[model samples]
Every structure is written in C-alpha cells, then in structure tokens.
Target chain A: MRLAAIALFALAIISALGACSKPPASERFLQDPQALKRGKGLFIGTCGAYCHSTRKDNRDAPYLFDCEWRHGGSDTEIFNTISTGVSNTRMVGFAGKLPDGEDDIWKIVAFLRASREPCG
Target chain B: MEATVETAVDMGSELALPEIPTHWTNARPIGHSRGPVADADLRAGPSAGQWLLYGGNYENYRLSPLETLNPATAPTLQVAWAFPTGTSGQFEVSPVVYDGIMYASSSYNRLFALDARTGELYWRYDHALPGDLRLCCGPMNRGVGIHGDTVLMATLDAHLLALNRLSGEILWDAEIADYQAGFSATSAPFILKNMAIIGIAGGEYGVRGFFDAYDVATGKRLWRHYTVPAAGEPGVETWAGTSYENSGAPAWTSGAYDAESDTLFWTTGNPSPDWNGDDRAGDNLYSNSLLALDPQTGERKWHFQFTPHDVWDYDGNTQVFLVDIEHEGQPVKAIVQANRNGFFYILDRNTGAFLRATPYVEQLNWASIDATGRPVVNPSAVPLEEPEFRVCPGNMGGMNGAWSGALDPELGLAFIPAIESCQHLQKGISVYADGQPFLGGTPLITDAEEDTAYGHISAIDVATGEVRWRYRDHDPLGAGTLAAVGGIVISGTQDGHAIALNSATGELLWKFRVGGGVRSQPIAFELDGTAYVAIGAGNWTSMAAYQGGTTNIPEGGNLFVFKLPAGS
Candidate 1:
C-alpha cells in the first residue's frame, strides 16, 4: 500500500509539471527567432549605434558583438545590466527609455547572443 | 560680490577721425537693466566693446574691429584670467561678452555668466539631459546668442532655451524636436529679428533635418524650413521612394544674416546613409548645399548645392560668410564658404550664381567642380559593394563645419581649419530604425591611412581662388579661426596650441600651450580700453579617430583669457 501511494504521488507531481505553461517570453528570448530580429533592430539602433559599437574597435564603448562581456555575459545578467545599467560608466539604464519595456530588453539580449563571436 | 578689473583698452584711436563719432550711445537697453542686448545693438556688431552676435555680426565674419590685440600685442599676450567649467568633454564655446559679463555655453548644455574681465562667475545654469541620450559627436554646445535681457541656447536634447541674461534663470523653454527620434542640436541659436533661429543635428540617425526660428518671447515656433523635402514637396523627386522622409540634410551650424539683402544664408549637411547614395538616387536637393532663405518666412530664396547626390558626406554646413567682394572687376554681393567637399566656393549672395570653386586640400580626389557649379563625378571614387574605393577628404571632409572658419573681409581671404585625409570606403547594407544610425556604410581606415592624415590652416584668397598659404600642423586644426582688424588670424590646434598667424602672410607669431587641446573659437573684446582675447581649451571626441587616439592629450575644460601686460 505504501509503494502504491509513492507511485501515485510521483504521478501527481509529473501531471502538475506538465500542466504548467512554457517559461515567460523573456526567459525564452534566446530561443525565439522572431524575438532575435526585433532585438537586432533595437540593438543596432540604440546601443550599437550610439555608445556600443556592433563591430570595430571604438574606445568610447565596448563592442557588443564579441563574447568577452565587460559587465555580465549570461542571458539574465545582460538583461539586468541593460535594465539597471552599470554605474559610473556611460552605459545608462534603458528600461525607462525602451518602448516595449522588458520585452524590448529581452529582444536586445537575443540579438547580442546571436551576433556575439568568440573573442580573440 | 562682483569683482571688476580696472584697465584701459580702446579701439586704436580711430574715433578721432572726422567720419567717426567720438561718443557713441548704445541706444536703448531692451531686456536687462545693466546688460541689455537690443536688436539695434546686435546689428551694430562687436564694435561697441561687446560680442552681441555669434558671428560677431550678422555677416558671420567673426571679425572684430578691436585693433588693441593686433599682431604687435599678440606676442605679449599673457593669461589674464582662467575660468574652469568643472565639466569635461569638447570645450567648443566662444563666449559672448556684454556689459561686464561673459556668457559661455559649454559641453552638456552648461551656461555660465561671469565677469568678463575677472573671470568670476555670477550665475551658472545646467540643462538636465536624459540618461538614455543619443549623440553622434560629443555633447558640446558651440556658443550662445543674446538678445534683449535673454540669452538663447540650443540643447543636445533638441530644445531651445531662453535664459535670463542677468541671473541665468530659465525664461522660456521650447521643444525643437523629439530627441528620441534621434534629433539633437549643438549650434548656438542665431538671434534674428526677435526670433531664436536654430538648426537640428541628426544626420547619422536618419532624421529629417530642419532649421527652425522660434519666437524668443513666447517660446513658440515661428517657422521651420525642412532641409529634406517631403512628399509632394518641390525637391521630393530627388529622393527615391519614401527615402526623402528620413534622408538627412541637417543644418547643424549657425549661418550669416544680411540686413541689407534681408536674406539669411544657412548651409545644410550630407544626406542619410552618408556613404551609400544608391537608395537616394537623384541630386539630393539642398543636401550639401547653401540655402538663401527669407528669415521672416523661413522660405528658400535661392540654393547652391556644393556636392550634388553626395555619397562622400561632404557637408555644405561649413561657415557661410556674406561679403561684398569685387568679383571679376565688379562689386558683387558674394557668399563664400570653405565647403567640406574640398573646395572654396563663392556665389552671388543675391542670385545664387556660382562664381568660383577652388580645391583647398591636397587629397581631394573625389570630384572636380565644373564651371556651372556641378561636380564632375569621378566614377572610381564611387562606393561599390564588392570593391572598395579610395576617396579624398573621407567622411570628415576637407573642412568639418563643427568649427567656424574666419573670413577676413579686409584681407579678402578665408582662413579655413583644413584637414588633409582620405579613406577607402565600400558600400554596405544599412537598415534604418527609429533613432538608430542610418550610416549606410561605416568608414573603416587602416593604420597607414590614419597615420598619413594631417591638418593645416589654409588662407584662400576669395578673389583669385588661390591658396595664399597653409600653416600645416602635425595634428588636425579642428578649432575655429578668429580674425581681427590688426591683420591676425587666431586658431587652435589639436596638439594644444593657441596660435596666431599674420592674416596676410602665413606666419605663426604667437602660440601658448594651454595644457589641453584647444577646440574653441577665440573672441576678442575690450573693457575700459583694455583688450582681451578668450578661448576654451579641452579635448574633443570628434578628433580622436583622426588623432588615432587622445590618450596623450590632457583633458579638462577651462576658458583662458589673455591680455597684453599693462603697457605692452
């Protein structure tokens, strides 16, 4: 009877997990191709165009198309950096400026991931 | 407490002549109690011991009648005072001195009203800029304009502000454009007939550039003259599809005003996607061109394009000078510009007829100007997707309009801060998004090419279209040139030298190392019969790429004022 109860409990846990929806759009930003395109537009227009250069060496700001991240490299870390900004640096928080808010920030993250190359 | 310096400086005893009056009144003080800058006062130019206009006068000559700081006294120039802005970026301000106060606008929209003679601050006003700001170049404000009791400034966030001339208090604020859509302004507002005239800067961000005149009293827009023609507009056919809407023809600098002709002469910059002109097919009307407009209505009276369908980003935004010159043995009202496209062009100010175009730089390999004022294109220099083409003047042009050049009407010569540089350019795909750089292709330079770049202060005789002489420098001469009645041309070098050359002969008479690169224009004024000259010394981001890097230069913002010793 104890073994039967354990199996039922395990089954119930699996059923609950299966019923849950997929992760939020922002969490799954890196995997979404459409989101990546939106991020490229945002990144190219804002960050890449002004402060950070998408390609080429510009001492004004870091080049965003390389794997050597200055602040943070992980998906969530970059999002946090973009939303909150690095202090004492020209990199300011774009959370308030971004029209789409969190979604746009996530899109920018996706774009950065797709374009980043292994640093020398 | 206001500190006053006692000195005796006067305009070289010229008033003793019978033609000139011994005692001249400043007429009515329009705005402020002590230092009012009236319309009549500004039109009288800087003759009254005050710098009332950005161009010294509406002619934009940048010439001062003060012979006190002539070539003789130039060598003995010693620092009388120095005012530190405490902010660092590009210190390109050319202060306006009126009554006893100096009004200077520095980087990040900081304006200071100080004792002109003592360099003691009376009041300070700093414009609040947004954290998420878009800027193509450094956040520099070239200078400020004064009229009545108000001083006018155009901010980097694309706003026209009127500050109380007496206390630096906010008088009125007018939004020029949406900064988020990539529009920003850096030029000093040109005060014309009670209107604060300003131009927008965002050629890199695909903005529809324009010059707007605002009612100084109400902060209301009087009229706006769009640089790029929109749909159904007269010049819309020059642009392919809807490209004209965002194609840049930015007027990012102040222009000269002619009270006689009642015409305002303003120049426009390059078209969008600076390096690739395939998308914008026809001659980009008014882009890289001079627009003679009616200041009252903001209507285009006449236009002369320097580089038609400019793919090289040769901006016609260089300083425009209105001079009455003897062209071909006849007195002609001429408009002259040491144009960025490697040429010094002179045209009839009234009719817009091209008189002459002369190449002012060594590496101007792109196009040669024909007799009819059109550029005879060189096919090899055109950008191609597969193979890159080497073009002269690069994207920075032979002369960048960021710094004003001086036109010595007395010498009939135009002193240009000339750059000798070139780069290989290839066409690349650029998709424009709102507030993003619309540079169709980026200018990539090799170390060898960059190392070969240098600059000079070239004096071009407007009459004969001949280069009289070039004061060459190891670094780019990025500072504006100032001419005085004493036959002296003053300019600064990127290597930190405030140099004064003989206006007629290219002779370097005096130079002072101010511990920082000098990128500002030097203005000469007199107080109590004592003559003083002022310039801002600091580094500029625009010259970084041309300089290879700015690590070697000392970086700080300070206004250095020099005057001859008590009895020099």
Candidate 2:
C-alpha cells in the first residue's frame, strides 16, 4: 500500500510539473533545428558580433548569450526589451530598423539564448 | 569673476586697422603682423611682438624665435596677468597675439580678444551649441585662424565662420557638416592663402572624414576631400564591401602646411567600429594614416599609413611636423610625427616614403614597425571575437592629438607628451547605429593600472632615431611643448606645474605651479625688449579628467602670462 501511495504521489507531482511547464518562446527557436538555423543567420546578418559581442571582453553592450539581464530575461520580457530598447544605453530600438522588424529581434534573441543552452 | 575690458575700440568693427593693428595704444611695438600669411608660408615671418602662428609658426613647430625670455632669467618669471574664462570646462586654446591684444578661444566655443599685458578683454564671441548637441569629446576649440581682415573660428557644431577681427562680428558662416550625425570641428581652422582649411572630428560616431577649405573672406565652401575613399576610388579595396559607408578616418587637429611642397600634411584617426574589423576588412587604408594633400585642390599628393587596420585606438590625428633633416647624409624635407601608436616615424614629406620608425615609450608590445612602415601586429594582440588580449601604450598613453606636439629644429628633438600604460581589448562585431557611437567593441579602458601609469616628455631626435633626452613625470604630461628660442623646452604637468627644461639635455631649469593644469601649448612673445611666457591653466579635457579618477585639476579658465622680473 505504501509503495502504491508513493507511486501515486510521484504520478501526481509529475502531472503537476507537466501542467506547470510551458516551453518559452526562446526554447521554440532554440530547439527547432530549422528555426535555430534561420534565427542564427538572421542574428549574424543583423545584430551578431555588434556591440553585444559574442566575445567576453569586447562587449560594450550587455551580452545576450546567457540568462543574466539588465532589464529582464523572460521570453516575453526579452522580446519587449529588444523591440523597445532600454533607456540611456546603446541597445537601440530595432522595432522597425531591422529588415524583419520585430520578428528579427525575436530571432536574434532566440539565437542568443541558444548560446546559453547545452547544445549552444 | 567676469571677463573685464581694460581698453578697446568696442568690437572688431570699430577697430583702427582693417587687419591686425600695427601698434598698441600704449605703444608696444606689435611686430608679429607685418604681412598677409599665406598657406605655403610656414614661416610667415614674425615681425610683430605678438604671438601669430598656431604653433607660433605655420609648420606647427611651437618654437618661439623671440629670445628675450632666455634660460638665464627664466627663474625670475612673474605673473603679468590672468584672463579667466567665465565657465568651468577644458581650456586648450592657445592664444594668438597681434599688436598688444591677444585673441583666444576657450572651452564651449567662446572667443575673446584681450590686452596681452593687462588681461583686459577687448571683445568676446560665443558660438553657442544646441542643448541636445551630441559630441564624442569635450568642446575644446584649439584657437582661431586669422588672415586678411577676418578671424576664422571653427565651431564645435561643425560650422566655419569668418568674423571681423576688428569688431568680432560674424562676416559669414558656412556649414561644414551636420553635427547631429557625429560630425563636428574642434581643431582651429587653418588659414592658407584666402582659404580656411579644416578637418572634421567624431570618428567614434562613424562619419566619413574629410579635409575642407573655405573662402576666408566670404565663408564659401571651397574644396573638400574625403579621407575614406569611396567605391572605385584609390583605396576602396582596403575596406571590404559596403563597410566603407561607416568606416572612419577623421582629422581632429590641423595639419602642418609645407609651403614649399604646397602640401597640407594632415593625420587621420582610427576606423570605426574601433576595435572590431570583421565588417570592415583588409588594411583599411588612410585610417591611421597621414596624407599630404594639395591645399589648392584638396588633392592627395601622397599618404603614409601608420597602424594599418588598427584594432587598437591609435589615432593618426596628431600633428605632423615638417622638418629639414639629414637623412642618409642628405638634407631632406622630412615629415616627422610622434605617432599615437607609440612610435616616432619620419617620412619623406614629398613622396611619403618611410624613413624610420622607433618606439618612444617602453610599453609597446603590439607590433614592431617594418622597413616598409607597416605594423607586423602580433597574432595574439589582434582582438578577435574570442579571448581578450593585453596591449601596451593604450590609446591615451601614447600621445594626444588634441593637445598637440612640438618639434625643436635646433635641438632636432620632438617633445611628445607620452604615457607609460597598457590596456586590455576584446574584439567583436560592433554595429553602426545611427545617432550612436560606432565603437565596434566595448569602450576598452585606456588606463587600467594608474599606479603603473606615469607620463613623459619624450624628446626624440628626428634626424636619427635616438632618445636624445626624456623628462619623466609622476603623471602624464598635460600640455603641448614649446621649442623656445632660449634653448628651452617649455611643457606642463597634469598637476598644474609649468616647467622649462634644457632642450639640449632635458635638464629641469624652471618650474612653477600655475594652480591649474596646463593643457595648451606654452607661447612666448616680446613687448619692446622684454619677453613673456603665457599659457592657459585650465585643462579640463583629457580622458583621465573625464573618467573622474584624476587629481583635482583646478576649475576656472585663466590665461596666465608671465615675464621675468626687470633686468632679472
């Protein structure tokens, strides 16, 4: 009975975890092979290697690879941050300047998040 | 206090002379202004007792031919007077004297003509910038250019105005460039013939640099030469693809005019994004290079690249000196520069042939210059997108183009205010955002360990690559050098000390604490037979000051003029 109860508890926790876990926008592009490739190309063409350097020392702007953030790091937050830009910083508003507009910023953010992932 | 006028004929319009006055009302023989100084006339011939040339002469030599302030009596120097600029900011403007009146520009684009002896203001002109003005550096005007009846002042917003020297009224104003797009002017407008030649600043904001000449009398835009070549132009291949659009090769200081060669030898700044070159590939010709151009047509006669494809911020914007030197046992017209890349370079001024390159500082580690004058950059020092690298003679440590440098002909020595320091650089792709600076990488720290950072007045012999003498300081040298006729090298320390050294040996002779740091060049002139040394003691420019870690450099702009006590 105790073993059955333990099993039931484990099943209940697993169910709750499954219900709570919702894959982020960053995860979608980061995990999907086609999406990641397109995002990498878009990021490199538009924002990669610029002031938000992939390199550690040369970054005049904040690094985007990791989860650390000056504004926020959530998927919705990162998207809004990139599209709107932070005040008094070089992180310019790329809402319209990019060829793909806001979509490009999301793609670049996804590529940057991939750098923090295991495969990245 | 306020700027006071002891005596004057109102403004430039009410003045007695159409050009510079021949004499002061108090009757001190004004000898510097005898004739109209043309572009090619490097030695416009100082006949008046007033300070005339920007470098005391057109060659930017900073040498005073006036011998009254001899070293024997230099110790007895006493303050004649001090003219205080009303604001608190950089004072790098070297005063130009005509008759007994002195004309100078202060920080924030303020111009004043004062009594040379009494510190009384004659007239003042203010070129006010817009409130939202974006500038890479502080607004420091390097004095004015005067020719015929007009005084040319280059505004920080990149406008050239011809003002009536007698009344200080604007005769005409010509727009040089749109300042909001990172184009501005701080270097003094150079007057040659009837044209005012000027080079624009703001490489950090990614504007294509150029050499411009305006009509001195009417302020008409004459000829302009873009330093960064466009598509199909001579040096375009050096820049990869469309990167040339934002590639930088700015000129922050005035060039030395070779009257004989009819060439304007100007130096260019580093390319943008400063440290990262993935976008702008190849050697990036003309960035960190010196070009000898025709003043008449703005045509490039010859060019010499100092630090090609520079990942380091070694700007070639420093002044180049034209000197007649013995190269290979022949008297050759050589152009010598105490390069910002920590090397002293001598080039054949006529053909831009590399003559010699020698390290003036002890901290150079990036690359040794080759016989062809190209830098053999260390593979490790090339800032890539990965690991970082340490570099010596970090940007601000080598030499300052804004303060300028001087060459002593008699001593054959170039007094370069250099620093002993290093920095760390990490290179990556930095994009060019409009209305923002184009520093490709992060703005690397130019000064890392201040304890290891000492300054020097590195006196390099231009004729031969020799360290003739060096005067070390606890901090970097603040001001430019003056190769005085009294066999003295007058320079200043960042800690407010104006010092005179034996130019032959760098032996300290006289020193005085002016209470404010001196970042402008020391100037000497005579009244009757008496000699006086004058300099501005408010140095609020420098990266060190801007960083807020430097010493308490006294505020207030005061032009301190000193003369030896009567009969010593």
Candidate 3:
C-alpha cells in the first residue's frame, strides 16, 4: 500500500509538469532542414564575420553573442533595426536589398536571438 | 538693564549682513548690471577700467575695450609669460579669471586654478575617466564657470561637475546622458542663478541630442529639453515616420542667455544619417534649428530652423549673439547667427521671426532663397549616385575649426572666420548588417592644390547684411576672433601666427608667431593694471585627419601670455 501511494505522487507530479509545458507550434519553419541550412549560410555570408567573429584586439563593432548591444537586443527590435537602418551612422535599411525579402531578415534576427538564449 | 541693551546690540549685528548660508560658499553671483561697451578694435588698451564678465559682458563679443597694442609698433607685443599646463593633450579651452585667479581646463580632463600675476598653479582637479570610452572628438573642455566659490565644468563623458574654487574638491557630480549611445559633453557649463546649463556633443555618432540644466547647489536635474521631439510629440509629423526618434540634434556649442526675457538660446546640429535623408523625410523640425527655451521650465518658447532637411551636415552650431538693435528705426530684440551653411541669419529674438538671411561666404550650390527668407535646397544636391557632387563650403563651412565670431558692438558687425572650400561626395548604395553600414557616401578629394579654399575671415554688417571686409589665407586653419578696446581684432591661424587685425579694414596690424597652430580663441584680461593676451597652440588630430596632410609644426600645448612693453 505504501509503495502504491509513492508511485501515485510521482505520477501526479509528472502529469502537472506535462500540462504546464508549452504547446507545439502549428508551423515551425525554422525547424525545416533546408531553411535552417540556408539561414546559416546567409548569416555567415553577410553578417557572420562582422558580427559573430570575435577579435583579441579592440572591438570596432560589437559582437552579436555579447551580453549587451549599443542599440538594443530584443528579437523584434533587432529585426526592425536590421530591416531599417539607423540614421547618421552607417546603419542603412535593407528593406528591398535582400533577395529573400522580409523573411530572410526575420530568419537572421531569429538566429541571433536564439544564439543569445541560455542552454535550456 | 545692561544685559537687555547688550542683547539689542547683538540683534542689530545679526540684521546687518545676514550670515552667508553654508551652501552659498562657492556661489559667485555677478549681478546683471550693464557694464561699459567693448569696442570693435583691439589697437589700444581696454576702454577705461572695465574687464566685465567672461567673454566680456554678456554680449559675448569677446572684444576688450582696451587699446594697448598698435600695429605701427607691432614688434612691441612680446611674450609676457608662459604657463605650462603640464599635460600632453591639446588645450582648446580659454581661461576665465576673476579676482586674480585664472580657471582653465586641459585636453586630458584636468582643471587648473592659476594665479593671474605669476602663472603659478594654485590647485588642480583630475576627474577620473574610463579607459575604454570612445571619444569621437578629442578630449576637450572649453573652460569652467565661476559662480560664488564654485567652478562648474562638463566632462567629455557627459558629466556636469561642480568644484570648490578654493580647493580642487568636487562638490557634486551628475551624469548628463548615456555614453554607450555615443553621447558626450564638450561644452562649458553656463551658470546662472541657482542653475547650471550644459549642451551635449555626438551628432557624428548618431545619438539623440538634447540640453539639460541642473540645480547649482545639489546637482539635481531640473529640466531637460530634447532638440528632436519624439513620436506623438508636436514635431512628430515633421519626420516621415519613426526615424525622428533617433535623429541627431546635438548642441555641441555653448548657448547665450538673455536675463531680461528669462530665455536661453542655443543652436542644434543636423539630422541623423547626416548625409542621407531618404528614410527620414520632411523638414525634420528642430534638428538644425535655433531653439529658445525658458530657463526655469526648459519649455520651448520659439524655434527657428536654419537648414530644413539638412543633408550636408550643416549644423547651426555657431554662437547665437543676443543683441538689442534698432531695426527700421525701431528698437528690436534680435539674435544673429553666423551659420555653418555659409550664411548669416538675423532673427527677431522674442518671437523667432525671420528678419534676414544672406550668404556670408562666396560659393554655395545647394540652395536658393525662398519667399520666407529660407534656403530652398535643391533636391539634386542630395546624393543619388556615385558622381562627385560639387557642394560648397564643403563639409566644413563658413566657420569650422573653432567657435569663430565676435560681436563688434562699436561697429555693429559680426566678425566671422569663413572658409571657401568645396567637396565631392561619392554616393552609392551600401549594405547594412550588424556593423557600421556603408551609407553610400564618402568624402572625395578633388583639388589638393588650392589651400586658400579652406579658410578666410570676414566681418559682416549686421544691419546691411553685407560683408564689410575679409582677410583670406592659404592655410586651412584659423581661430575664433577676439575684439579688443582700440580698433583691433585678435585672431590666430594654423600657420602658427596670431595677428591683430584692424577691425574696420581687415588689415593686419600686429602678428606674433607662436610655436604651434593656434586653434584656441585668444582672451585678453588686465592683471595688476597690466593688459595681457593668452592663447593655446597645438596640432589636433581632427584637423590633421580632415586636412589629409602631415603637419611638420611642433606640437605645442603651452599657454603663451603676451603683453605690451612696459609703459605703453
């Protein structure tokens, strides 16, 4: 009887944890094998060396995976900034420049955001 | 009965002068009393006995009324003394002295209090600065302010600090703005009754700019007025969209205050993406504007936009001179601005009403005059392709190197250091990622042979809106004007020469060859009844980089004090 009670408590805890978990996305484009591969290629080609690459010397531009950004770090803010350039300094808007359009910009933003997240 | 009489005497003594409060120690309030009028020329000794306020009595004419140096006897102007700042950085700040104590700032963030008579350092204050902080411009502090016993100064890292005049201890320190976004302070703090006002620099680095005032005693932020209004604000519609949020409107230079009107007048720099306006369209209200705000509340009373939709980086950073002038036979409070866009603007000080706008320099192709006396900029001037677009007065305009210009009340003329150069901007489409975007434009070199294309000095008649006279030089560098008592105008140049020019004719009166380039404004003062002129000369990095030329001139950061031979 004692062993049965203990088993029931463990079962109840597991059920509650399962219920609290997030639901699966209706659509997950980032998980697509081709899209993820293409996204990585584009990020490396355009922004990989400049933003992702770290230098032993003084930093001219900030690192992408760094804890702080001179402007902002949120996913939406980064996406918007990337699409629309900052004024004055050399941040130009890429609204019509990208081949894949807004979708490509969004992909890059998602990758950057995910890279900043801690291990789950 | 005797004790009661003694108590009455003590009460009488208490009412006599009212013991100065503890907070009132460093406060030196110069009451707003009208001093003598400074003359246009500096040929002789300062007029009578008036030394007046910093920059000589509120008008900021910077002209002394003394006439001690004569052009005929030019050789008489000799080095009176040399005060070593004891630092390696360039010294761009002019020293302000009161009661025989001189206050000045060195390039590397050191403040010195020196004895006026002997060039002896009384005390020094070094505000600790961070190592990794990037300084877009050089580390320069213009000067310090003296109110009571307090010396107020702004740090390059955007901090306003008040120091005890007797000792070099910091009384209070307050941050002006965030440094990460490229915001910094280089202007000297102007101290008024219980308030210290300061402006920020960083138009080049794409920072949102504004000016703020703080409580003189406690360093409490009193009010902040943004040069560029945000979304839902009054000037939001002027911007095409949300780009106005980060528009660059730096107030890098000091402002002038009118005591009677209780108004502070300052100029703002150009809009962000400095050379391009494709994304952020419309006039971009208040970016390149002269703003008048209430000193107490920091509320905008009126604004006058000098350059609408400025794409040439034409900052209205020239000193705004507040003068009461007779216009059309009527007394009018007017403000005159020697604009960086190669133009002279005179406006009604009270209402921000347009009075007159005229070209102060020789060459300009970007704009023409409209019905409202505004520059109707040609859209072609905007960079669309990589073709070398010829634009005048180049990036550096009518007045560039330093804050040039002095109000000559004697002649009612504004003496300005004018440049006569043109630049070719190569514009093309550039990619934007996480780093600095290549904003499709670069400064192109066209004619390196024409050295005179870089600078000149001109005196403009404020009433007639005409250039009375001009002195041109082949060197690309020149200093701000200092008008003195007689009829002399003292100015310096990058060629390592400080000259006293005839204020009326622009003829060279007296010239002294300093060791290095004279970038600082020469200031004249009387100590122990002896008239002296002090200036700093040194090679700066910005000037060297912009000129794209090597300077063989020895770098000099020492202050040279000059005076007329004994017994004028």
Interface RMSD, per-candidate values to 1 decimal = 5.7, 7.6, 10.8
How well is each residue in B193-217 modelled by candidate 2, as lDDT tens digits? 7878888987877789887988877
Q: What fraction of native interface contacts is shared by candidate 3?
A: 0.00
Which regions of candidate 1 deviate over 4 angstroms?
A1-58, A64-67, A73-120, B1-35, B447-449, B546-550
Q: Best candidate per DockQ, number?
A: 1
| Range of the 10 consecutive residues with the lowest summed lDDT in candidate 1 chain B | B20-29
**Candidate 1 interface RMSD, angstroms, 1 decimal:** 5.7
Badly placed stretches (over 4 Å) of model 3 are A1-120, B1-55, B69-75, B86-90, B428-440, B445-452, B545-550
RMSD of 3: 12.6
Spell out the clash pairs found in candidate 1.
B8-B529, B8-B530, B9-B528, B9-B529, B9-B530, B10-B529, B31-B149, B273-B440
Off by over 4 Å in 2: A1-120, B1-42, B45-48, B384-388, B446-450, B545-549
Q: Candidate 3 has what TM-score?
A: 0.74
- Deviation (Å) of B278 in candidate 3: 1.0
Candidate 1 second chain TM: 0.92
> Number of the top candidate by lDDT?
1
**Candidate 3 per-residue C-alpha lDDT over B1-568 given as tens digits, one digit per residue, 9 for 90 to 100:** 0011111224456457543221212233232222312222111223433232334445567777566644543456788777765555346776766656667776766777766666766676666665434354456667776565677888877889898776656789899986655677876676656677888877655567788888877899998888998878898788887777667788887777777787888789877656667767889888889998888898999999988887777888777787777777878888888888877888898899888888888887878777576898766666543444677766667675345577777688878876666766544222332223222243333322233355668888886578999887666544677887566787777667888888888898777888676667777776656777777766563443344222456564777778776786
**After TM-score superposition, what is the CA distance of residue B446 in candidate 3 from its true location, in Å?**
3.7
TM-score of chain A of each: 0.70, 0.63, 0.60
**Alpha carbon lDDT at B493, candidate 3:** 74
How high is the lDDT of residue B512 in model 2? 89
Q: DockQ for all models, in order?
A: 0.15, 0.04, 0.04
